[model samples]
Structure formats: structure tokens, C-alpha cells
Target: MATLEIDLFTARSDNFGVLLHDPETGRTASIDAPEQAPILAALERRGWTLTDIFTTHHHQDHVEANMALKDRFGVTIVGPGSEADRIPGIDTSVGDGDSFDFAGHRVEVIETPGHTAGHICFYLPEDKLLFSADTLFALGCGRLFERPAEVMWPSLLKLRALPADTTVYFGHEYTLSNARFAVTIDPDNAALTARAQAIETLRAKGRPTAPTLLADEIATNPFLRADDPAIRAHLGMEAAEDWQVFAEIRARKDRF
Candidate 1:
């Protein structure tokens, strides 16, 4: 099997559009279609025909160009089963724990329902890559729009359990702001301090800070550090349940 080739590009302000291709089979898939123009240009540039679309949720920005792209390419659309009726061009619906093959690669669907009630993430184990969408981000997690922090925390824990080296590809380019907020919550964390400085340099250059390593997130992301003694102590929730600690951190971020 040939290694998967991934192309990451900007679309619709801060949204990141991704294309995944299997070089051996010449099969390609777009992670989300925030808009049609850039995605089309990307495909044209690579000369890769889009065979499928893997949507993470029903958010308009995430699925706005679904129909246009599908019409243009006649591609297969796959998305969360819970939001099948809501997604614009869904053809195949999958839920948590479901496994499907994409050009000989096994993709696992993980139901992550915090950002939205039907949000899902795609994990390709062989490649150690996870398309987290809006559920998780670098140094931050999605706002609880449709679910409570308690519900969202468990969803994050599931992702945390993946191998430390798994590369996480999230939906937006919110790292710079997220890093700033992370420092406020984890003021004493030396690792976070250094990470924030690095993010500043990247943003200064107008570069992308996504596809972050899971290990770095676990080490520096406050949302993923609710179990860490230092973070729990800073929140004065050392004796509180992990969920309680998570809730406090999320509430603080909301106000930050």
C-alpha cells in the first residue's frame, strides 16, 4: 500500500479544508467542503479526482459546499448517521465504532457529540491520523454549543486514549487564540508557555498550526490536562472529580 498524501488548505476564513489521497489507488477524499472554489482549485492543482466526502457534522460552514462539489464530481458523501437528514449531501451514514474501507484503508468513525449533538470524527489507525473536526483543537476544545461540558469531556477522553503519537487534524485555525487562553488557565505550565511562544511565531508568519501531535496536545492543552495534578491544583479542584475540573476550565475559557 502506498502512503496516504494529505493536502491542507484554508477555506472560509479560519476553516481548514483537507484532502486525503491514496497514491497507489489514485482515490481521494475531501474531509469537509466549507466552500467550493478552493477545494476545486486544490483538486485541479493535484489532478486528483475526488471520490468521496467525509463530513464530520451538519454545521453550515462545514457542509456548505457539499452539494456543489458532489454535483461537480458525483462523489460519494459519508457522514454521521445521527445527522443524516440534516447533512446536505449525505449518501452513506456511519455512527460510533463503525468501520469502513476507503481505498483499502480502514477508517473508524468515532461519535464525538460535544460541539454538536451529532458530531463525529474519523480515525485512520494505519496512518495514525485523526480528523477531529471541531471536537478537539490544538491547546483547546470546541465550545459546548449543543451539549454540556460534562458530556463533552468524555468525548475528549476517548480521543486522549489514542496512541500518543497519533496526528490530530482539527477543523479550524484557532491555535493562536487558543494558546493565549490556555496560558491563562495553566499559567504555571512551562511547557504551555513555550508552546504559546512558538504559536506566536507561526501566526506572525501567517502559517497553519494544525495537524498537531496528540502528545503535544496532551502535554500542553489545558482541556486534555484536567487530570494533571498541576492543573487540578491551579483550579483548586484537586479533590474534585475529573469532570468537575473539566467543567471549570471550560467555563473559564468561555469567559476568557
Candidate 2:
């Protein structure tokens, strides 16, 4: 049998909320809740209803619509173990290595604590799709708001270790801005130049540049390329520690 079908819907200005459907069982799971209208509109268009919600963290933009959606559709809300107390209407609380079945597809939970103490990413191994919340963006990463740079480093490294082919669906739509920052880090990276041009073309056509593949991000996104010798040398770093490189890239972004 073929892998399940996944559809990505960009909600609000920069958020790309995802809908994963299992045809075998006719079930659907939404990755995040940035707003209710987009999800409602998408589901109405597809003639499908939401059954489950997988939250990555407790951010308002991500979780604010949870209750409204659950009340409207009676969907089960699943979130990380660390934030169960804070997440409203959580039906199931999970942690790293936890696996659950929905619509005959196995979804594994990965603990990625950095952006938030309880941030988690959903991994569908069969499909090689990772629903990276704020932990990993297309060309940029979430601001180290709740945690220090030290905590976010390991979390990012874990996501980077996933197979290069893994398709990443991040939480926001910051690719264009991120690509602008990428050029400063690796001015000589041909991939970054090409990616910026492609992104600009898409934006000009009013299209979204999202659902970036991990391999492509590795090629252009400096955050995921912490271990690359070229990036390390550019930052004047010695060790290939993911956090060390992460710190340098993040510091530069803050000023950029």
C-alpha cells in the first residue's frame, strides 16, 4: 500500500497548518491550530472533518484555536507530556518515543524541547514527514523565547539528524525573510542564491513557500547546517557542536 496522503494548508499570514488523512480508516489529524477559519474552510472543501489534533507547544497562535475546534468538531486534542497541564482539553498526553495510531497510520512523537520546554514534533516514518513546530522552520528557527540558546541547540540537532529526505512542515511562513538572512551567513552558497530567487518568484505570484524538504533546508538553511565545515569556518568556530553553530547563526539573525 502507498503511504497516506498529506495536505498542507497555510493558515493566517505565515502559519502552515497540516492535515494528514488516512484513507484506510477515513481519519484525519491536524498538526496545529493557528486559526479556525482556514482549517474549517479546508475541511469543508475536502468534505472531511477533523478527528484529532496534535499540538507541538502551548503558544497561543498554535493552541488558541484548539478549544474552538474541539468544541465544534468533538476532536481529541493530543499534546506533549510537559504541557498537558497548560494545554486546554488535552485528551492524550504524549512524550518522546510514544507511538499512536490514527486512521491505520502510525504517528510517533518526538520530544524537541527548545523553543518551549515541552515542544514536540510528529514523525510519520512511513511517509518521512516531520511536523516540526517552532523547533525547526524552513529557513529560520523560532526565537529562543522560553528557553536559553543552550536548551534549543540539542533540540535542533535532534531534528537535523532525521533523514535528509524527510519533508518538514514547520509552523510559520518565514521562509522569505529567512532566506534573506541565509545569504549573509553563507554568501558564497549558490543554493541560497537560487533559493532566494525561487522564493521571490513564488511570492511575486502570491504563492506560499512552505513544506520545505529537510535536504533542501540542509543545503540552504544555516541553522540545520551547523555541522558543515564551511559554516563552522565562516563563524570562526572550532568544534562542530550543533549548539555552538546554532548560537552563532542565531546571534547574527538577531542583528540582521
Candidate 3:
């Protein structure tokens, strides 16, 4: 009955480093290696040895410590197959709809390409945990760097379809800024206003705002509410498609 042990810690200026350990099988994986020192220190403190690195994308900030930790522990590196050529030292290439086992738990790979053309998310249904990387954030989605809002909206739907109880761990600590922007677009939402106020307190206390519950994000995150009538009215896109609303929101955020 032992469950997965997740070690969440801060690394670099805004990155979060997550280590997943299975007590039953003694397997450990770093969701994405943001920095070498922090990953190693977290493992050292937990007394867990690294056996795998499940990479979410080709971004340097996410994969910077891949080789360093791999060389240190000889851990296997798993990454997106579509970006295999770009990912450094990828030993396993997995794609969208592909899944694999991690210490008896099923790891579902979802291709979310707006943040990066090959950015992926790892969802563990049994544990209700999602390593969202840079795809979906607390109150905002990742900037449309590699794809347009049309493509990103569908990618987000893949996550929004997940169980409400799922606990999400994202790549960066961008919640406070995201919250600031969210209140502007979803001003009429009581849930969002309250959540934004709480984010202010959380950041003031220097607490991490990540590992947010999917249910909370669904209720308050404007990015996930493009189909909601209130937000559509706010943007004067009452009859527009969901992605169009999403595009307007993204553009506003970029300018904000």
C-alpha cells in the first residue's frame, strides 16, 4: 500500500524541481531537471537514488541538468519522441498517446505543443498527479511560443478533461504574476478574485503556489474558462469560438 513519494523543491530563479520515488520498487525519477545541485540535494535528503528522468520538452531550463544527473547515477532519460533529435541523451522516446509503467503506476504522456512543439505532460491517474511542465499554469497557460491559440486550446482540453481532484505540478513559479493578469480578464469571477487575493498572501509569505489542484484551476483560471459566458462577455466575443477567446486572452497577457 506504499504510495509515490513526491519531493518538490525550488531551483534556479523560478524553476521547480520534482522528484518522484516509489517506495515499493525503490525507483526514483526527476520530472524535469532544472538544476543539478538542487536535484542532487533533494535526492540526498530523501535517501533516494535517481533511476530515471522523464523530460517534458527540449527547453534548456527544463533539461539543463539531464546529462549531469544521468552521468551521476546512470539514470535512463525519457523524452518526447517528436523532439528526440533536440533532446540531449534521450534513452527512451515516447510520444502522445503512449504510456509506460513507473513502479506499477501508469504514466500517461500527453502531447501539449503550444509551449513547445513537443512539450509533454505526465499524468498518473492512480495518484491523481500531473507533471504539467510549461503547458498549463495555475492561473495562466504557457505563452504560445511554438503554436497558436488554436493548437494550445485543444492541448489544454486534454488536461481539463482530467479528474478534478488531480494535483498538478508545473515547471515555474509564475503564479503571482499570472494571478495579477487573471483578475483583469476574469474580474467578475468571485472564485478568481478570492484566489488572486490568496495568491498575494502566499507570495508574500514566500510559499510555493504550484502543485495546485486541477479543480481550483478549472474554477478560477481564465485560460481554462474560454468557453465560459462571463469571460466571453468580458472580451466582447460572446459568439466567438473557444480558441478565439483564448487567443484574445493570450494576447492581452503578452501585452500586460
**Residues 1-256, model 2: lDDT tens digits:** 4467677788876788888877766678889888999998888877777888999999888887899999998999999989998887899999999999766567899898878889999998878889998989888888887787778878877787889999888898888888889988887899889998899889789887778899988788888777778878888885757677888899889888
Cα TM-score per model: 0.98, 0.94, 0.98
lDDT of each: 0.93, 0.85, 0.94
lDDT of 1 by residue, 1-256 (tens): 7789999999998999999999988889999889999998899999899999999999999999999988988999999999999999899999999999998899999998989998999999999999999999999999899988888999999999999999999999999989999998889999899999999999999999988999999999999989989889888898998888999999998898
Clashes of each: 0, 1, 0
Q: What TM-score does prediction 2 earn?
A: 0.94
In model 1, state the lDDT of residue 151.
89
Report the Cα lDDT for residue 121, model 2.
93
